[model samples]
Target: MNKNKALFTLTLVFALLFVWTVAEAGSSKRRGTAGAMELLIPIGSRNLAMGGSDIAGVSGVEAGYWNPAGLSQINNRVEALFSYQRWIGDINTVYAGVVAQLGRIGSLGFNLSSLDFGEINVTTTDAPDGTGETYTPQYLTLGVTYSKEMTDRINFGATIKLISESIMRQSASGLAFDAGVQYSMMDEKLRLGIAVRNVGTNMRFDGPDLEIKVQPPGTEPGAAQRPFRVPLQEFELPAQVELGLAHDVVASESIVWTVSGSFLHNNFSFDEYKLGTEFVLNEMFAVRGGYVLAQDPDEDTFYSLSEDFIFGPSFGFGLNYPLNATTHLKLDYAYRMTKFFDSHQLFTLSLGF
Candidate 1:
């Protein structure tokens, strides 16, 4: 806690959670349902290079979501990742991750993701009511990341999480923390990163229908049924402050080139930037692209950005292969573009030993 007092306590907790979530959505009276569908929770798979350097030169098991200090660049005992998205029509996304490398006492990761809205048909008003409850809107995240390579050009990491959310029954769960740092230069080409994600606390949803209530069945006094707490609700997650940079151009023993950039500090939003590039043509063939925004940018950071469909411009592309050389396998793809939903795709599969 001394990087200028931890970046001034993470810029004063991201400016007081972005001014209390923009004053609770400018005093919402039910305006746009308080961030629904998060456009599918920004589906990810290394943003498929569409966001290059995905936080800091991603490595095996997809670094558990792009950074855990690049998972110590994996020494590989086991690493895996899976993902899929079909945005633009009936949105859908599924993600998976795995990692293991306990060689000197460091390295372990596991992650799972889900987002689907393929079922819905439950309503009520008693018979003016449609008593048929069909539900689906569950999100889960169980994570663990620990990395070490604290030398030869810096590396260190941390991640911990347990989060859950349910829909038709209004559920909520929480716990979160993450930390990162990575640096590699010259000979290794170049790389730099920083992370301070999520942090912790603020998920409140109780059991028993938040104590269900219904009056007028016999003039009962009043004031009892309460469990409200939902305004972009959170139990400490989605707090971001990532900065990244990358470089790798070794063209010749096959070929390799990478370029990346990223910066974000979204407490709920406003402040994002991404630029990417990747080309590996021989280690097994690969290609990539990138672009993202929060207020149109690739360079420019002093502070500024309050909102706008989260700023536009986004792109993607991917490829990879190699199933031998001690053991290796790879595949990745990505796409992102939104100003009003309808553009996002991701896929990832990896292995290394």
Candidate 2:
């Protein structure tokens, strides 16, 4: 009887989340208005390999970025992950995280992600021809997460993240919060997850780059210059909500198969749908595939492919090796197809102890 009640409650929560997502959908206003947009980029190769559809099924350290609620399922005492991404436009990213169990209390996680934009020539109004100087833009994020199993079938988690963006002498910093819930039903074969991310302060650029020495309008050429600073505009963070569902098709001693789907609601951009599937053999080897769909597009444009930009199909593979009774290593790789430029590739390694 209790099991039935629990299932009923879970269904009700899912329904409410779905309705809330739909109510906020189809608003194209304020597109590209958000700053620190990099936060919207998905992390964790294992989750990305599954087409960024692991919001309901992620486990351990990867949960810090995908769905913190999944961190409650950390079976191991300690889990760590290191990932490298070859992003678009020759940019590179390094992501790392660790989650440690806190006995009966909960799980604590620390994550760090950094992006290197490489060196580029700095140009100014007077140096449009050539600046002869170069500068590198850097993006970094740090997060602390916590998760606990509220009940046998329910989990809750939250994250506090700090974002930093720097270029030459100018930089901006802000904080954001993420909260998520996960519900498991039907003997843990069905999973549902809801997460709201990047809810916090707005960001704007500042620093020495904004300062300039200017002469008064009536002053002569040799007159002393006064210091003036450019006023920067504040922009909202990339806030979004996600609803994901996953079901185990085959749960056996030696083989397991799963299928998952997710809906993303963006406050400043178009909505997206993700579908993914994974097959595992003896929990050692796996293969996965996924596709992304854009909800709206400019049909009048000649190049409209459903109004999609870079999101297309994605595929990946994984391997898991157990070194000892209490230790294991895992590797994951993913390929994301794009409409322009080169495709993105991610490689990740994880250790469990």
The global C-alpha lDDT for each of the candidates, from Candidate 1 onward, is: 0.62, 0.83
Q: For all the candidates, what are their Cα RMSDs to the real structure?
A: 18.9, 3.2
Instruction: Give candidate 1 misplaced runs (Cα > 4 Å).
Output: 1-55, 58-91, 94-114, 120-131, 136-166, 169-182, 187-196, 206-208, 212-249, 252-254, 257-279, 282-353
lDDT for model 2 comes to 0.83
lDDT by residue for model 1 (10-32), tens? 34654565455434321122323
lDDT at position 181, candidate 1: 71
Worst 10 residues of 1 by lDDT: 25-34
Q: How many backbone clashes does candidate 2 have?
A: 0
The candidate maximizing TM-score is 2
Off by over 4 Å in 2: 1-26, 218-224, 297-307
TM-score: model 2 vs. ground truth: 0.90
Checking candidate 2 for backbone clashes, the offending pairs are none
In model 1, residue pairs whose N, Cα or C atoms come closer than 3 Å (at least 3 residues apart or on different chains), thus clashing, are: none
Error of 2 at 277 (Å): 0.4
**In candidate 2, residue 184 scores what lDDT?**
86
